[model samples]
Target: MSQLLRRGVLVACLALSSLLLPLLPVSTVAAQSGPAVTTDKDVYDFGEPITVSWSDAPGNPKDWVGLYPTFAGPPGGSSGATLWDYLDQGDGQTVTPEGTLTWSQQRPGQRDTWPLAPGEYTIYLLVDDGYEVVASTTIRVTGDTDGPEPPPEDEWPANPSDPALSRKLRAMTFNIWVGGTQVKFGSIVRAVRKARAQVVGVQEPGDNLERLANRLGWKHTFTSDDGYTNLISAYPLSAPKRSDEYAWLRFPGGGRVAVSSVHLTPYPYGPYDLRDGASTDYVLFNEGTHLEEMKSRLEALSALAEAEVPVVLMGDFNVPSHLDWTSATAAARQADGEDFVRPFPWPLSMSLAEAGFRDSFRTAHPDPVQQPGYTWTPGYPPPIGDQPANLTDDEVFDRIDLIYVHGPVRTMSSRVVGESYRNAHIRVRPWGSDHRAVVSNLRVRPLYRR
Candidate 1:
């Protein structure tokens, strides 16, 4: 028999074979070669195009692949495939054994765009246009693809003409990786001095907060028991609270601002999990665990939010802001070849915003596409202690370190401080820490005492 004839016979038997597959032992199927289908990526941002590749097809012109939502059940002719195409053009009777099909705004023979919603989907390689699956695989499409909020407009003035109207409070948030012991401690001191930050929130400050304060002749410093979060200010700090270290900043100019420094748990991070095809609920649950732990701190901040005083919360949040990870920005990044980010409402950052705090960097530079302001690491993979060496390939650089403000404070300007000129507004030579620094200039309204 000719190869085509044998393939035709095999194609005819495929439907019968599929009916018996459930009754046969699993090993029987494992031993046989069959038509196979796969996607280029297991996960994709919503609205991003999808590509389905198949091999070992029966080569019948009628053999086709159908895209279906994972829960849509077995491919039935009446069920209707979300998108499909014949192995060969509809007119041809011969098909190659292997080929690829892409679905974007439209596919062959389809005029309307059928964009897959955010969820799991299945690709089926069926026999002779019949609903007998020869091989199949799953892929995830995720993102908030609807009603993208307009990018925020820059609200700060081009240049403050009045000294009184100019921003007076300069705050910096830095995760000095392992207390700046990663490099010369002096490098950390110089970074703060050069930024000219009046107050600084320091994360992972193990005994280094005081050392830094001493070097700068700063009188006040607060450190947590776990050595995870700390604060060092040029003025004095009062009413130091625990569980994320909330303190009262007493500026010499007679202004008091509420400050908190926090370093939330980093494991089971949402971006990594989401990229690995985890469900949105699972990602939100992971971040919710952190928020549950910081409930007291959040409540206190909420009360502060209701009060008349200016409040500043800063540190390594270990999570991305919902403002930065919008549907619009996800599409923007995918256009530039970074495809993992999606519109995820990270609970911690969203909760803070709900409590009236604003991301200072984002407040100054509202267009996420234009100013990503990534502060998580100047060096990808970092090559640092205890971090997995494979991080270079898996990690997404993000702006986790932040200085958030609320009440009578307006962000004049915010910029990143890092190891290089390209990523940082203020470059510090031989940057001491893995995470970059965030500095924001704020115009503060004086406290009104009754």
Candidate 2:
């Protein structure tokens, strides 16, 4: 009788234990049947946004998923001070009700959007109420890395390029990608001629500024051996004073206007050059550091603006103006789509503004909410030309190519010039460059008492 009773109790206990197993933590119950988590790409550009996908993830309060710095440590997330990029003390993230991590799950950390520097890192989905990681994958962070408001009823000028104004100077800034090799060169020449601007500046002008100026019947001055940037004037330009980074030109007839065509550090160094080091500043909050680290550069340009002649500085400034980074534009872009990047004031512009240079485009188009006036990329999807697709779907179409003026300058109009498929600007045949030209008509006086 005693033996039979003991056997019955053992059987009952076994049955109860099997029933209780289903109620334990999810990590103990589910076996990872597929890829636990993975990024779409193995190697990412310096600031590239990643798409991390996973087959299953639980939305429980005791679980979480995050990307952590692995350094030269273990990939299993087992043996290091795994610094999670997020400050999430919450239960779950990047997990769906249907048990999947979507493209949108590749979100940046809240504290530092640019979390990863150029190095190796790992992603982990954890379950010890936040201590033990159940699944993990690795990713690489290769590189480093606007507007406005308004409650006003905007009144746009019909003839924004007001011709009636005297002392008006028209200036055009062109990156002329690869010295205008990307597009038919003749088209660029024709476009410049058609604009009839007194001042023209080109970035990456290559070793052909003199010939190109001759072809356009414009006087040019860029004595530097680097030949990366050139300053041309319909009015004769006194030989440029050269620097390792820029060229200074003088237009005595055009009210003693001093001009400089500068090509600042292009990527991994320029202001706001995060994530692809080109058109991707909006999403990252850390872009200001690049500009902050380059204060000496800002002062040098400021000194030029304060020089004897009123300055009309132009080039692929490689930095956007502060006008595009107001609280108003941020609110507007919040609903633009999942891919839209959040923009910061890109500190270089702030530096220039503080130094007294006026952004001709912003001066003319005061309402950034109304006139974004993007000068990079033809438009989203690049509707025409041999235009290439953007590095990312969320790539920012910014106005980095700029023309800034100082010393009592008034902007009458500023318009972007290029292929007019979507922008409706005057159409140029066989688009001549990757960057559309920034042409601004301004009324100004010479501060130089020559």
Candidate 3:
């Protein structure tokens, strides 16, 4: 029994050692975790379903998984709370898993459509194994595409014989908030049509030019390929051009009245580069490149300003009305014959003023006491339990929205609409654009007649 038993035991021990040696590493001995779930699509278009799949593990499988949608502020605080949370539960359509571990889950099906408004949504999948959530990358649901076509050109009333009546044109510059469903095309269309603005300058259009123009029955011209900022008017556009800083539309009204729509380069006070930077204040007062671009554009625009045709420029300038201490000190230092630190004061507004332009709002209503208007602010009440003091203090109390006249134009009245301090009961949500529309009545004396 000695040699035979010994050889049998040695064989058994060697076999056991082979198995146990591989399992000695703590990393290898641990049981395999849940399956790795991945989604084929990062973004889901409206009326389209997303299919998700997983890498199967070599073990007993779990049956169920859960999905949740969450939201967050944009990179630069552009957005507030997650809008998806407010969506009705009925809006979320889901599919239950048919089989266990090794199976794929197709949401809605290939033909099924997810009817969600345009936004950035994330879908989270939690496997029944109690493992951490397997998340699909953020999916952006962009607005539905109707075909693209050139905006319609419409006719305008003939110039009046009376000089006083003919020169008078009512203009409105509005910053339509395109971030959400709050102030949509329907509301804006109704407002613009009712206002009957001869020429409307709009900001933050958000690629909805076609929808907006069609809804309002007005013609539009956009600055970018993506159509972020646009000009919608009853008059025909001559030639439209854009730079890094601004977009200009040449409106041929007798003589050429060039309308410049600007979205200035944001101030570079924040930490990150513009490409990936996030900030509480994304409103740039001066972009170095944008400043040069605007300067060049303004020089070009000055040529269009003839004695006969007046150029009226208006939009969100993203700069303060007057020079601050930083600018004042820099100017003084330069005058003293010393190399001074370059001042980045709200240069755009000041540049326009230097280029023989006048601010119409200041001209019309000289006193700030009479019309204390602040345009940019979070339109809703502060979140529950938050202080009203905090709310009031957080408002962008500066006057960045301005209407400027370059050549021969007189401002009869320029005031911010819908600002009533005495009546705290007024709701700004109905007229809920981020900017208060700066409306002005300009008197343009015809160059030929004058």
Candidate 4:
């Protein structure tokens, strides 16, 4: 009996030692490999709240976390983009492992109205260890509301009649001087509607684009990097495809119209000190050529205009047109006196014409003699930044701003729209810019798309 009792005690002691193996210090293991994050739900209704949490985050309890809206791909380069919407107060707040945050239906700021529009957007969970984005993940949400409503017609002025537009479209180019601060924004908006242009482009829209888009009730609006130009339309606008010299908007629907807006190097000579005189290689290099950037861009615009889809190239060219500077036209404008330089085909205009685009204004006018169609001034005495030495009252007043288009497009009617101070047409209010606006009505040859 004694021997059997000792054997039983030894067996029990061995079992107890085996149970202590896992509790040893070196034997312990972490619950996770690296930082991991997740959301409670993949989708949610508009204004619906969501919970975001992180796990396996090997860090101090007080680590920073942030939430932002991103497009797609890893958190770098083109594949990834971060919108202005940031959920946190600043970069983020410190929190513990398995920390959580809530995304309410409402985002901060005036642009963030609750019940977001029904569009797919990505939510990014960014863990920043003070200096950089450590780990991240994304959640997508489709808005659940009928989009925004347009202001009543009575609220805004009515659009002008266009009985002539059966196959073509009208495009307007307006340089809203100083970002339209010179005149009432309503006046500009009303002027646009009166022209009844389907597509409108403006120079110097600056930061006021959203405000302009809001008032005009345009479905689409695009602003250039420097706010030098913008394109607004009633129809949907495809994402802008751009280069430093130009930006193009693709109009999607039955047929696409690639609209390119450019504010070429003004004077083309300010930086080079040659803007005041003629150049050696007139074609390859000209002081008035705007450092040849204008010619280069116009060439690019021409190539784009030649694409399968029709293209509308418009803007304040700042350089003279080849048609106007011709010996014949020069004789006509001789009233302005023999100008500084004899007629030489400006490279900017020559390149565009060669690329297959005709001046919409000239096309509609046919006779430059009857209607010089000067776009430089409308008699508004507002000071201009580009007042140069060679440009006298006559040369300063010549037509420079232009609308160029290629393909099966015909100008039904084209006219200058602006204040009547010095214009042939009756004065229209809201024309405060030193330059007048060009309104061109064109018939686009129907190109049906599936």
User: What are the lDDT scores of the predictions, listed in order?
Assistant: 0.73, 0.59, 0.47, 0.57
The 10-residue segment of model 1 with minimum total lDDT is 155-164
- Model 1, position 181, has a per-residue lDDT of 79
Off by over 4 Å in 4: 1-166, 224-229, 240-253, 269-284, 287-307, 338-341, 379-395, 421-426, 446-450
Q: How well does candidate 4 match the true structure in TM-score terms? A: 0.54
Q: After superposition, how far is residue 359 of candidate 2 from its true place, in Å?
A: 0.9
Tens digits of lDDT, candidate 4, 388-423:
222234234567778877765666777887665456
Cα shift from native, residue 373, model 1 (Å): 0.3
Judge candidate 3 at residue 162 and give its lDDT: 15
Model 3: residues >4 Å from true position, as ranges?
A: 1-166, 220-229, 240-256, 267-290, 306-308, 323-345, 378-393, 418-429, 446-450
- Best first by lDDT, ranked: 1, 2, 4, 3
**Predicted structure with the largest TM-score when compared to the true one:** 1
TM-score of each: 0.60, 0.57, 0.49, 0.54
Tens digit of per-residue lDDT, candidate 2, span 251-298: 455346566666654433222233223343332233454455345545
lDDT of 1 by residue, 1-450 (tens): 999999999998998898998998665345767779988999988667888888999877788887765654667622356567777745437776798778886552332324555677788898886888889999988775343332332321122121223338889998888868777788889999999998898888876778899999998987655554478898888764443547777766676788888887665456655655556655564465567756777787767656766778887887888878877889987787666667767767777776777788887788888898988766632433454322345457788998887777778899999877778899887778878899999887656452
Off by over 4 Å in 2: 1-166, 225-228, 239-255, 269-297, 338-340, 379-392, 447-450
Question: Which is the winner by TM-score between candidate 3 and candidate 4?
Answer: 4
Report the candidate with higher lDDT, 1 versus 4: 1
